[model samples]
Target: MTDTLIKVDLSQSAYDNDMIHNRWHPDIPMVAWVRPGDDFIVECVDWTGGQIKNDDDASDVRDVDLSQVHFLSGPIGVKGAEPGDLLVVDFLDIGAFSDSLWGFNGFFSKKNGGGFLTEHFPEAQKSIWDIKGMFTSSRHIPGVNFAGLIHPGLIGCLPSKEMLNTWNTREAELYNTDPDRVPALATLPYGPTAHMGRMQGDAAKSAAAEGARTVPPREHGGNCDIKDLSRGAKVFFPVYVDGGGLSMGDLHFSQGDGEITFCGAIEMAGWIHLKVSLIKGGMAKYGVKNPIFKPSPITPTYNDYLIFEGISVDEGGKQHYLDVHIAYRQACLNAIEYLKKFGYSGAQAYAILGTAPVQGHISGVVDIPNACATLWLPTEIFEFSIQPGADGPTIFDTKGIDVPLAKDL
Candidate 1:
């Protein structure tokens, strides 16, 4: 048996675990040490750190704290890793603990953590997916089942104080531009909710006050949320400090290209089988400042897809110039509208797009006036035929089955 280097007690609060931390600060002590070529197992609580529940009623989702998230499993130090080297990681395998065979996906209320399509669907809602080996399905969403592409949604190394200052300064600049916007432009460091692993006293307090929130993907790759970076993938992460303090959590059983739902993906408590190595001076060798990766060779092939297109026009019929965000949002909205004709409520259709292996593409950007984006919905994931036919469409008989919702307070 491979040694379980850092084991988490999921039954306890993630904050109570010394092995877990929510903020990124170089001063936080490494919990474990390993050498290059070492392979081990590390367990993690779900991203919300056990706040979201297995039950229906998205009240938990609605009230969930956005700040206290992405509780990561390690600052596991690699013996020889240093700044400007690449800490190479191979995700040999990833699986849910037998005790946790389920996961939750939810849309956040716009007032809280708004999603990509927060305007169209602006309240907190949730769907629970039950995992059965390689496959998953939801009682909250009937007539849909698919194999998951499991992966860690967040992973990265500790930033040197200089790098950390750059992140805070740049993000704060964006936040100040529209500081009061709902969900804010960017999440800044907050001392109250930070979990600085083993750090204590004024040191922990100061670091927490400036530590970067694990919300957006940064230069050090904090939370990229890419679905393709799954089990079997090999990633080369840029080391920013000595020992290359690497930490990761936010395991997702399945998710689309963009986790369109804010409380997104089939979020679960899981473990990763990882092998770490070093690429000496590989940062400059590869011209890499951002993390680079080779995706998993093994993945589910949902070949047949019904593709939907959207331009940069907003829902209000206002035209935007080459905006990929607006274009993707329109594509998602179009898919939801089409699915509604097949008897799925908009929320169910939206949740399906979030948890399934859907694809979003930026097809055109140089075209004048509008950028074209496409949403590819896999037909195989659905039990019934979803293709357009002369018979128009078959209503899927959803039978009042819908994801749980908690109206925004």
Candidate 2:
């Protein structure tokens, strides 16, 4: 039989709900599983279900009940998918409703209150801004890639009853804060120092009042907005509940790393096509929780590590370069150690890793005190083996030192 493509109609009232607060109910029809080579397309509704039109403005955005903004479709069942299996969602394509561009002051703008720059530009605010016309040309370049790419910012299945409630409460508290104070308050580090203590207390009280919604990351994945979860990317999610309780929202058009705005790209309408497959008998082994990871295979090599500094630039153009270089170096070191656990010799690991290690800058500066950098080894380096013990670790062996190739899930 030809693989079937499931069409989920978001236009139905049963699927309509507030984007921010709704969770995928198991009752929604789910897409079934197919073999590795099977293919299909799934239709999705705009985050607003077309209720908010193309011409809607800042007033429309402001008046939106925070809960009902980002509606998504599906919890499509993958037939034969059990609790321990992994749902491999291959994103084949994504298309937006139309080419019309739109932009508004984001959650970080002064008026909306709360961003890394709030302290520096205490008065910088925009009530009704248009980002459609802004464009820049490079000195050596001849053209501009119209900035737009849609992907969800928050996508994952709910963890547990308590965790979902906590996430909801936190979001509510964040929404109720004075737009001005929100930015600063949200960025404050949790601690016992006077300022941190006070902020934590207030946040705690706010969360409690808002019904204690929380989202914690664990073996059962919660809110991980890894930007790579886009078209052409394959995400392997472990099933927790019987139907997996899959849900996705927080649409972004284009966003830099670190999603400094705590928001991403354009929040608009689009549909994502996914194919679900079962990874039989794969569960959290080695105490590993959250059975999700980018499936890009990396080869081992030894070479000088590339490094980049992550810095936040203020509206006044001030630059805050945190010790990003140190962070980058440490991350590389950590990778080496992690590989050692897999049983590869230090020299072999370093040599294989050095083949191509690129340093990446995560936009931590966009939000104060949330700095991050990444070191990555290219997936092309690993040579895949066929016979199990012929040469290298088994594909399933993500542990051990001195080798490469992640086991196919």
Candidate of highest TM-score: 1
Question: How close to the true structure is residue 274 of candidate 2, measured as C-alpha lDDT?
Answer: 59
Candidate 2 residue spans exceeding 4 A from truth? 1-21, 24-39, 48-57, 98-105, 108-113, 116-150, 158-223, 295-409
Scored against the true structure, residue 165 in model 2 reaches a CA lDDT of 52
What local distance difference test score does each model get?
A: 0.93, 0.40
For candidate 1, what is the total of clashing residue pairs?
0
Model 2 lDDT, full chain set: 0.40
The clash count for each model shown is 0, 48
Give the TM-score of each candidate. Answer: 0.99, 0.50
lDDT per residue, candidate 2, 1-409, as tens digits? Answer: 4332434344454233222223332233343434444565544454444443334232343233333333444444455656666766676655543443442223233444333333432332211112243221111111112223345555554344454354555655765585354433332212221111111245533432332111223344434545456666667777755656555654444444343322223444445665556676566442334646653232123243323332333334454455454454445455545554444434333322222223245435345543565655433223432222445544324343221211211
* Candidate 1 TM-score, true structure as reference: 0.99
